[model samples]
Target chain A: MLKGKSILEPMDMTTAELEEIFDLADEIIANPPRFAHACDGKLLATLFYEPSTRTRFSFEAAMLRLGGQVIGFSEPNSSSVAKGESIADTIRTIACYADIAVMRHPKEGAPRVAANSTDMPVINAGDGGHQHPTQTLTDLLTIRRRKGGFENLTVGLCGDLKFGRTVHSLIKALSRYAGVKFVLISPEELRVPDYVRRGVLEANNIPFREVKKMQEVLPELDVLYMTRVQRERFFNEDDYIRLKDRYILDAEKMQLANENMMVLHPLPRVNEIAVEVDSDPRALYFEQAKNGMFVRMALIMKLLGIEVE
Target chain B: MIVNSIERGIVIDHITAGTGNRILDYLKIDTKKNTIAFIMNATSKKHGRKDLIKIENVTDVDLTVLGLLDPNATVNIIENGKIVKKINLELPKTVTNVIKCKNPRCVTSVERNAPHIFHLMDAQTREYRCEYCDEIVSMKNE
Candidate 1:
């Protein structure tokens, strides 16, 4: 049913549709070879308007692993977008060549514009301080694997909640599940946006508490979603420098977390998480990166309507 | 103060005082071509003070824009100086190009051709969210 649909945001897909993607991801993990040829004779166009390492790689790797060919530009300068081509025109041309396309743009809803321009399915890789539904998918799949389900879970989202599109998308996606409480740990400057606070969380009547410190909420959480205070998002270097290291999750802080609590981060992490914390059993971010590819594989197959028995 | 009523035109009444000019600007009605009466800070029985716009010989106005600009305002279509139809204004579910997405990062900001679309997020609060960036803008009359 998700065939030919663009995932511009997490909420665009219903809970049942999310479950379908997750189930397919689990099956792909169990036996990768079964879905290898799922996208054979297919092409995936990666249109990255901004600089990216993991998302672009994960998407290309996913397509390649699924026996599909990949074609795209890593940055806008390499493509006709450098000549000041509009997104609608670029996507219209891309649709002619690629069966499916994924775009990461500097402007929010650029993917939606592209999706509107073409019948070819488009996935939002990441938009500027907006929805990153794929990262939410990766986070959900990781949490599902570690915690079994989303119900009755205390999720701690720490650091840079304001500009973190992944946090907003994940919070909105998780709010649909019952008994999910949030401990929003961020500085006053980087608190969640008003729309996210009032529109998504409070609108759903979900229980949540805003805190300045992470220590108090660490033990209560089933999942700790850490984010970097991105330098790119800030116009002032002074403000970014002051808030970037506000909460560094070292081994000492990890001790306070529950034994079963999983730590997740949409990577390219700066100094927010210590290198020593990566070796901990709770750190699932690296595995989360791998899960990103699997989830995308399932996504590509679903959008392409390529089913495997 | 007495003002002549319009014939084959529209009358907008009960706009929150001090917002009459803004609503008029949104309507984009040409003052040179049409006979327009803009009354501001008029005493009202229900509201202490209100604004009204009575246009003569012009009935074509985007009710959605009017509704968003001033939801409490009432609209009456006049035919031969008699009221024909009255419209009770309500916030529309969706509006296109009425309210610009002020979010600097929104797609509409860059792409001039992109429609400035917003959807009613909370009707109780009279808040609309940008279709692209999800930035909230409340339509509460000041």
Candidate 2:
């Protein structure tokens, strides 16, 4: 039933279905060449309204590795969107040429609108401060492989909690699993939004605590998820500069964390994580990025109903 | 101490004082088509002061919206000048097309013809948030 399904939000698929994708991704991770042609002759349309070179490159790399062709624009100006075409019109038009479409737009719920207009499958890359289901998939896959499973883990989400789409999606996804404790770390001004706090955490009766500093809750977390303050989300540069460095994960702070804890980041980071910590075995953000492609491969094949050999 | 009874209509009682007119404005009770009588400053055993809205010869009301406006309101249906049924209103879990999301970044704001939907997250806290964006739609202002 996951085939031909539009992924507008993280809750689109059940946990068991997500695990199926992870199982296929794990198989691909073990031997990449075997499933190289699993999606032969297929086409993937990456319609990015806003330019995200890393996410665009990852989805493209995933489709290419599966022997599928990739098409679509990286920026709005390069496509018919610049001509004032609605998202509904553009996605419906693209469905004629492409088998599956992955879209990243600056407007929240743009993909959902497109999905309703197209018969072809639509995947949300990252909406404007909304759900990023694929990124949630990447985080889940990484956590499953690295930390064994989603249960009995104290996950600390740090920085820009108010506007981090990745954090919002991850919290919604992970809160569904058993024994997950949330330690929300951010300045008082930038705590997780009330909708997230009330919708996911309080509604589910999950235990969570709010704190100001990362170091105060370092040793307690099994996973330290770092996020950068997006420049576009801020109107004033001075506030961004003042608040950006407040949660920087330096080597000294990392030393206070548990030995088994894994550090993660949705990349293109701007000094949130120290360069020296990249050499540490606990740093999983790079591997997390690599795993993103594999998971995307699994997702594409699953949505296309392609039987991976 | 008696307001004339209607042949067939809806009588909204137990509304918090001064809110009956707001409901009339929201429901757009046209006085030309249907007769509306506002019973304001009525003394009640339970409420110190209460308001009532009596609409003559009207039925098939959208009870969902009335529940959101005031959870404590009561509606009585009259048929042939006799009370047929009484309805006690409770807050709906989700409301659609009622309140506009105030957030500029919200999809509901930009997308024309998009339905404005709000989900009641907390009943005790009276918290309702936009379905698309998570902006808390404060009930106090409206």
Candidate 3:
């Protein structure tokens, strides 16, 4: 039933649907080669309107590792988009050539528009500070694997809550589980947007607290999800500089955390997480990166309706 | 004080003072056929100061849309110069094509022909969010 299903946002799939994907992902994780040819004849088109080497490659790798082929542009300039071709026109063209499309656009809801225009399944890679459902899948998969379950965990989402699409998606996904307390650690200006507060947290009646410092809330979190404080997301240089160094996760800070508490970051991080912390046993970002590929593979199979052994 | 009354039309009353002209423009009132009277800064006991628009020979004004423009507004149906019916405005549930989605990432933003639909998230707060991207359509300044 998941065949030709487009994933524009995290909530595009129900909790049961998400659990189905996770279940398949667990099977794929246990034995990689058994599902290698699951999508043998399928083709994945990566229409990256923006340059994203990590996300594009992960998707391409996911498709390739599943014995499928990859095609499409890394940036808009190389494609007909540079010639002023509309998203509708571009995606309609891609649908004829590919079975599924993974699109990353600078504009929010670009993939949703593309999904509407095409019968081919469309997967949103990342839209402009919008939903990145695949990354949420990766985060969920990582959390499930490391922590054993989604319930009763204190998830600390630190830094750039205002602009980090990953944090927003993760918060939304985590809020769905029972007894998941959210510890929003960020600067005042970068606090979680009111829409998320109203729709996801308040609407769900999930208990959450906003804190300015990580130290005060570090020990309580079961999952400390760190995020880069990007300079581009800031309108003022002084505010960015002031808040950038405030949330750095170093060994000294990690020492304050519980030993069992796993640290996660939606990788390609800046100085928010120090290099020394990568060597720590609790840092799960690199492994989390690898998990992105596996989760994406499971997602592709699910969307294509390909049965895995 | 006898004001020009419509024989059969709509009397939009209790608009926040100084907003009569904007409502006229927003509603795209057809001035070619219907005779319209715009009363700005009119004294009202309920609202203290209000604006009113009385359109002659027009009775098909969209009440749901009028509610969005001015929630405190009341529409009085005039039949043979007597007020036949009165309506109190309430915020609409889903609004289409009135306001464009502000989020550049919103599907409606790029797909111009796409319906600019907004779901009323909090009716009490008059808050709406985009159906496509869930970006809260902040009412401030809009």
Residue pairs that clash (backbone atoms under 3 angstroms), model 2: none
lDDT of 1 by residue, A1-309 (tens): 899999999998999999999999999999999988888899999999899999999999999999999999987887898888889999999898999999999898899988888999999999998889999999999999988889999999999999999999999999999999999999999999998999888888999999999998899999999999989999899999899999999999999999999999999898889999999999999999999999999999999999987
iRMS of candidate 3, Å: 1.9
Query: How displaced is residue A118 in candidate 3, in Å?
Result: 3.5
**Model 3 chain A worst lDDT window (10 residues):** A227-236
The per-residue C-alpha lDDT of model 3 at residue B5 equals: 67
| Candidate rank order under DockQ | 1, 3, 2
Number of the candidate with higher lDDT, 1 or 2: 1
**Docking outcome class, model 2:** medium
What do the candidate models score in CA lDDT, each in turn? 0.92, 0.87, 0.86
- TM-score for every candidate vs. truth? 0.92, 0.90, 0.87
lDDT of 2 by residue, A1-309 (tens): 689999888899899999999999999999999988988899999998887977899999999999999999987897787787877778878999999999998877778778878889999999887778898899889999987789989999999998889999999999888999999999986788877898889989999999997888999999999998887777689988888788889888989999999899988798999999999999999999999999999999999999853
Q: Using alpha carbons, what is the TM-score of model 1? A: 0.92
Q: CA RMSD for every model?
A: 2.5, 2.8, 3.1
lDDT of each residue in B3-65, candidate 1, tens digit only = 987668999999999989998987889998888999999999999999999999888787777
What are the candidates' individual DockQ scores? 0.70, 0.50, 0.51
